[model samples]
Target: MPKNAKKKRTQNYKKQIGQVPGALIYTGAKEGNKLHLHVFDYNNEDYKEGDLDSVEEAFRFKDSETVTWFNLNGLNFVNEIETIGNHYKLHPLILEDIVNTSQRPKIDTYQDYIFIVLKMMYYDDSEKIISEQVSLVLGKNYVLTFQEAEGDVFNSVRQRIKTKKGRIRSEGADYLLYALIDAIVDHYYAIIETMGNKIEDLEDDLFTGLTQEEIAQQIQNLKREVLKIRRAIFPLREIINRLEKNENGLIKEKTTHFFRDVYDHVIQVTETLDIYREMIWSLMDMYMTTISNKMNEVMKVLTIIATIFIPLTFIAGIYGMNFANMPELQYKYGYYIVWIVMIVVLVGMLVYFKRKKWL
Candidate 1:
C-alpha cells in the first residue's frame, strides 16, 4: 500500500509539471536540450570566471568564504536541476515554485536560503512585449540565478563583478544579490518611459481630431499594455518591500537600504500605472463625445436639407399635375416665374440659416 501511494504521488507531481511544457525551470536539461552555466567567484581583491557546459561543472568550484554567482541560462532540463538542488540541499517546495513560471513575484525564506521569483519584461525587435520568469536563490556564500532563456539585461552587473569596481566585490553575496535585484528594477523605468511616450502620442492624435473608431482602438491597445505592466510591477513592489524589511542575515543590513531604493522605484511604477489607467478612461470618454458630436452634425445637415426642400417640392408638385384648369401652366412665362420664385425662397432659407448660426 505504501509503494502504491508513493507511485500515485509521483504521478500527480509529474502531471502538474507537465501542464506547461514551455514553462521555465531551475534545472538543466536531461533529454531535450541543456542550458549554459556561468559562474562568477569574487572577493575583495580577487575575482575568477568559471563558465561551464554543465551545472555540475559550475558547482564544483563553490567555496564557503567567497561569493559565487551561478547563472543558469535555460530551463528545459529537470534531472540536472534536481541534482544541483540535491547538492545544495535546496527545499523541494522552492524548486517547485521556481519551476512554475506563472507565479506572482514573491520571496520565500527557507532554513538555509531565500527564494525569489520576478518577471522580466522587454520589448522585442518586432515591438512585441516579452516576459520571462527569473528565479533567484540566495544562500550563505552564493547567489544562484536562473532564467527562462539567455540574453538577459544583467550584463552590467556581471561586468561590475568582473572588474571589481564599486563596493560590489568587497561586499558579501547579499549585496551582490541586492545589485542584481536593483538592476532588474531599474530596467522597469525604460518600459515606463516607453509607455509615457505612447501616452503622449495618443494625446496628440486625439487633439488632431482622430476618428472615433481609431481613438477607441488605440485606447484599448494602450490600456492592455498598461494593465500588463501593472500586473508585472505591482506584486514586485510588495516582494521587494518585504525583502527590504526582512530580518534575514542573508540580506545584509547595509544592503537593505539599497533594497529600499528598489522599493521606491516600485512606488514610481505604481503611480505611473495609475496615471495611465486614468488616461485610458479619459480617452474612452473623449471617443464617445467625438462620435456623438459627429452624429449630431450629420443629423442637423439632413434636417436643414429636408426643411428647405419641403416647400419647393409642394410648389413643383402642384404645377406638375395634368389638370386642364391649371392657370399657371397656361401662362407665357410660368416656368421662368416658378424658377425665380424657387430661387428667392432658397436664398431666404440660406440667409435664415446663416443668421441662426446653424450652417
Candidate 2:
C-alpha cells in the first residue's frame, strides 16, 4: 500500500486494535481494601518523599523535571484507583487492564504514556509458595506501579533509591523502570536457585529408599512447583524480549541495554527450569524402577521358598495317608530319614537359585 493509503487506514487500525483485549487500557483496582501509595521524586542532588493518602495528594506533588516513582502496593481501593486514572489522564482501557489482574505480560504505548503489564512474582518465606500479579503503568518522567498486595521484589531497589547510593538517583524515570524490572528478574534467579536446592534434596531422598507413598507425593509436589515456575517465567521472557526490541519513545535507547540484561536473566531462568524439569522426570522414573526392582526381588524369594516346600509337602502328604500298605509308616527310621530329606531339599533349592543368579 502507498503511504497515503496507509495514513487513511489509521482510524480503522485503531478500531481493530481497540477490539483486542486490554489494548492500551488500565484496569482499576478491586474494591473493599485499602491501596498503599508511595511517591519518590529524586535527582542527582536532591529528592522529596511522600506517602500518598489519596489520588489528589499523589497528583499535587508531581514534578515534570524530576523522576517520580509512584508505587501502589495494594489494588483493593477502587475509588482511589479511579482518582489516580483521572489525575494521570490514563486511558479508560488502561484503567480496565489494571483492574483485570489476569492480563498477560504486555507492553502498550499510548499517546501520553506507556502501559506495561507484567507479573511480579516471588516466594514468600513464611508461606513457602510463589505469588504473582500484574504490575502496570509508565509515563514520560513518572512511573506508576500497581500490585495485588503490599510486598514485592522491589524492596532492594527502593532501598537503593532512598539512599541515593546508585545510578537510580541520577538516571531518568526510564532507568528507574529498568531497575524495577531488573529487581524482579533478579528474584527469578532466587526462585530458580531455591528450586534447584529442593530438587537436589529430592534426588537424595529418592536415592535413600523412600516409601512408594512418599515418593509419589514428592513427585507430585515437585511437578506442581515446576509448573508454577514455568508459568511465571515463560511469558516473562517474551516480555523482556519485547522491551528490549521496543522502538517506542517510552523506552529510551539507553535503557534498552538494561532490558537486554533482563532478557538474559529470563533466558537463564528458563534454561534452569528446563533442566529441573528433566531432573524431576528422571527422578520419577528412578522411583518407579526402584519399586519394581524391590517387588521383583520379593517375588524371587517367595518363588524359591515355594519351590523348596513343594517336594517336602508331597513327601509329608504321602506318608501321612491312612493306607495300611504304606511301607514308610512301618519303618522306625522313616521319620528321621524324612527330616534329613526335607533339610537337603531346602539347601539344594537355595544353591540352585544362587547358581541361577535369581536370589
TM-score of each: 0.87, 0.86
Q: What is the lDDT of residue 187 in candidate 1?
A: 75
- Candidate 2 steric clashes: 13
Global Cα lDDT for candidate 1: 0.79
Model 1 — which ten-residue stretch has the worst lDDT? Answer: 22-31
Q: Write the per-residue lDDT of candidate 1 for residues 48-138, one digit (tens) a residue.
A: 8867877778666556588999988666666666777778888777666666666678888876788899888877786556777788988
For TM-score, the strongest prediction is 1
Alpha-carbon shift of residue 30 in model 2 (angstroms)? 9.3
The sequence of per-residue lDDT tens digits that candidate 2 reaches over residues 45-129 is: 8888878766677785455788888877666665666778888888777776776665667777777777787776677865366
lDDT values, one for every candidate: 0.79, 0.76
Give the runs in model 1 whose Cα sits over 4 Å from its true position: 1-34, 212-214
